[model samples]
Target: MRRLPWALSLLLFSAAPAFAAEGLDGKTLGLAWAIPFLGMLLSIAVMPLVAGRFWHHNRGKVAAFWALLALIPIALGHGIGTASQAVVHTAFLEYIPFILLLLALFTVAGGIVIRGNLKGAPGLNTILLAIGAGLASIIGTTGAAMIMIRPVMRANDDRKRNVHVIVFFIFLVANAGGALTPLGDPPLFLGFLRGVDFFWPTVHLFWPAALIIGALLAGFYALDSHIYAKDGHKWLDPTPPREISISGGINFLLIPAIIGVILLSATVEWGEVTIHGTHVAVASLCRDAAFVAIVALSLFFTPATSRSENSFSWEPISEVAELFAGIFITIIPVLAMLQAGTEGAFAPLVALVQGPGGAPDNLAYFWITGGLSSFLDNAPTYLVFFELAGGDPQRLMTEGATTLAAISAGAVFMGANTYIGNAPNFMVYAIARDGGVKMPGFFGYMLWSSVILLPLFAVVSIVFFAG
Candidate 1:
């Protein structure tokens, strides 16, 4: 298992020398090329459900199989050069920065343990969720989740009906809460990189975000109150009352450092270097390097006891890194098709978002972007729709503001619809399972989202996106 990443890395590096001059043309690629990508998605969705034990032990092998399925065919058909460039480009430009940020946030947030007993009453739980939602826009969903998850878990440690609590937490804190700022979510950050103003989402998405978040909060409160009343409102305090204190105070400083690194990558113009035909941005490279340092800093400075109290482990992040590596690789063709616009295989999909009169259908854009985002990675999904809506940030921000708003809202809000909808959703699920929260399996969880979120989204569509 440990050798799997190294082995895949070696395959990519060895193939790079063959493809130093050319790249695959998405314009000519057929729909069949996306088979491996679909295979990978199915494996993720079905493997754990049908063969939980087998998947648990060999998930890395499964991911590698699908990745190789794509790589081998791509290399054979397009020459090793194109395949290698794709691999290198995805690895250096996309996957590295992505996993590094997750690593840094997970490490730093895990290091800061809030120590005290707090009752998981309906009011307290709602307040904590609200705080986490607010903090998400400032520190990021991953950061807020890591910082808030354990404390929320501890607060409800003795409760019988707490799965819904964590589910709503994922809906609000890990996904929806990140709607306001670029710092809040990766999709918005990508939009920022593409020239969407930093506060554009704040101005445009505020009402939509407020509507969904407020509805979810009120719904959660109602459900929690019912559960509390049914359980006789039992007061269970294992530890004696004491004021809450935080350890690993230094990690609080690292949060801003993470934000700074991200901002630097966005604001700075550091030029680019061509690596085997792939253009690697210097600012991005520097950001990833700083993330490595941040991870080390948190690990070195944080007390071991702090992470232990938080129940932190590398398994969750490792799982994400491995799984998403395959996803990023396979998704290349799918993204390419989407990027190809009206000439590509996804032209029908592009057509769906347009009205009969040839105008952009705001409601269709909202649901289509969101529906795909629920299963696909939302960041890239956001990029796809952004391009589909005409990739001019200036136009999207002004005259096409409604279209942009719909894409933004869909990507951020509906990400909570599935565990794979966003990166943090699975991490939160893993952490909750580690804490013995008995979280639902993939489809089971979606059932919850369908019941709670789908109706609210319907309202959002009608109220905000309707013609």
Candidate 2:
């Protein structure tokens, strides 16, 4: 992967249709960007079948290998095309780092304990659900999903028919829960980079997050009660209390790591960087390298056994590694395409709020764009819509607070809409399935969301964003 930097210059001057169109420079650019992205989508759709048939014996290794393959087209297509350098840099430096942060945190937290021996299924559900939500911002929605999923699944393992339980769990824990912090989800992380204050999401959206969780728990209780009643006879022996062990809760170190990275980025110069013609910060590169090294070292050297006597195995970590490797590889190209398209053809979307009905139109734009994010990649979806919101001079005339509020809120909240809306949803689903819980298919999962999540989000829309 280090060789990727070598191709940067070569990718810059490559000739392709994306750069050849006369009156459609933007369209050409969009297509070039799309090359890698489309590759990713295809990989996701087809890789499962291919891996299942050809590499079922070692899906993780196959997935990891293909993830690397997915990166090739993205690097070749976007790295050398007539694509915008700004978008490319943003994709790699800003975006990739955020993803990596969540990944590292998820891996670390997954090492922690979630006592599966607890009785009172509802109580277990509430605590795990709360933990998932609280951790979402720090770990990224996906990270929290990876950490909590096995335990959540374990808690409800016998209730196989109640798949909605898992689906709704994704809605709250993996998606909406993260809306309150940049660490929570990619969209908010983008906001953090674009001048939004750190801690802003927590201050603004905590209540809304609480409301969503409250509603979700209520729904879970009602559903769980019915399921428990049906499965009551089957609830034979509640697992005995055994200490499940974990390490790396060194919370104090996280603060310094974060500060050190920021300081380092501020001090060095990066590629294509220009600071009074001197250079941009190279600290980002160093920070990223150090961050990765620290995480790898911690995971490697940390004792696999907890002090309580329970031992750790690589099974869960291996599963996350395989699946996320696939995801990271495949999505790079997709993000490249989205970033390319966001500027030209996608520009007119900004005009949606300009004509006639004004603020109400903006509100509609908010929901529509945000709702789409629930199904699409919320990060880019966030950037596109954030641009749309910011592009409006009238919106600028309005309070900055209101404008930022709408953009950040929509991007963060609506991510809960689907299984793939945020990264963690898939991790949670994947981990649960690994524990023998049957996860819903693409559209089937949507059906579950519609029944449980939609109504609750609708309430949020009314209470918070219905201006």
Candidate 3:
């Protein structure tokens, strides 16, 4: 969800002016237009720390306030029709599908709980993390995290020092693991939607993803072993050792069904319908509808006991929805400026990625994309750089292979740099916290990533992007 606010905001603002007789050009728009978007980001970052109670209760209202600040000006400048159309375009074509997929995965995975009493030894913990990383590419980071997290938590329930376990889970399962496939992460899915081949990432990102995951797994093992030895392995096991079995098996079947619907949407172009002067793709509409149906099915068929066992609740998804609505609304102008390329207000950003000989710099692509994705939403950050590199999928896949790979690797891997770097990272954090893991505060988590993940990313950059 880290990228959702920034990505969604940029998209809605960019599209808002499209219906006007004379649309606002990014070249003509000034930096001041991006204030509301920045405000929304600041509110998200600072409010929770300064006014935790107020932020928790009124985050939706705060999101709405920032959104209105952006929209009111757009309506005035481009007329109400243009603003309305922009809202419709963003809602139908982007945000709805995005949220629905997350909802479906969360719901289905929540229903399937692993029943076990395994201890969380260093070797076992490493194996679980490895399994999760492998599953992430197949079922998505969100799905894999939802399915695996509770089991991991249950295994480590007796450990006095378990915060590092959850932190590394966020690093590996929730973010970096999703790099190898479109289904693995939202940014890659967006690339798929925009005409990048589905297997392109698989072909290009395998080694980079493997290297990072391997490094993290090794690092986590060393850290966990030290903590385990320091604690004298004297912690009482909460659940007596027993054979592991799975409950709510039906939901396992639903995971692939969700993936199928997404694939159907991408492969089958069923034409589109124009609503309020915005073209809505019928395939996307169908995909979203199917996701809703899947949600219903998961809730109906899976016994309430299973969900209860997983400690499933609606608060996380609800919070993401409310806050991201505002983000999507506020980011419209900033995305427009970036989309304007060299002619726009963000011309300096456009110029920064070019090399001395005027070609696109792969290292700059990796760092800039990763840096923004670390704080903002990686999906739109990937898009910004994708367009900066000329936005030709065919050319990017062929002649600019390294550049595309750099962008993809950066967007996916560096999202682990912070909890807000991706949607699953925060959800994993919230779940870990609720499950009694004293997860670090936002900055605390950043410190963990800074010490551990940053150096690994530097090595990756040198190996993959520096050439």
**Top candidate by TM-score:** 3
What does candidate 3's lDDT look like per residue over 240-274, in tens digits?
A: 77789987767888888987888788788899998
- Model 1's alpha-carbon lDDT is 0.83
The lDDT values for all models are 0.83, 0.56, 0.83
Q: Per-residue lDDT tens digits of candidate 2, residues 78-154?
A: 44332333324443555445545654565455455555444436656767777787777766676567656666665
Candidate 3 residue 15 C-alpha distance from true site, Å: 13
Model 3 whole-model lDDT (C-alpha atoms): 0.83
Q: Write the per-residue lDDT of candidate 1 for residues 66-167, one digit (tens) a residue.
A: 788877877788777777878887777666776677677778878877788788999999999999999888778987898898888888887877898999
Off by over 4 Å in 2: 1-88, 158-162, 237-240, 244-246, 249-252, 259-279, 282-286, 305-344, 353-360, 391-400
Estimate the TM-score for candidate 1. 0.89
The window of 10 residues in a row where model 1 has the poorest summed lDDT is: 7-16
Candidate with the larger lDDT of 2 and 3: 3
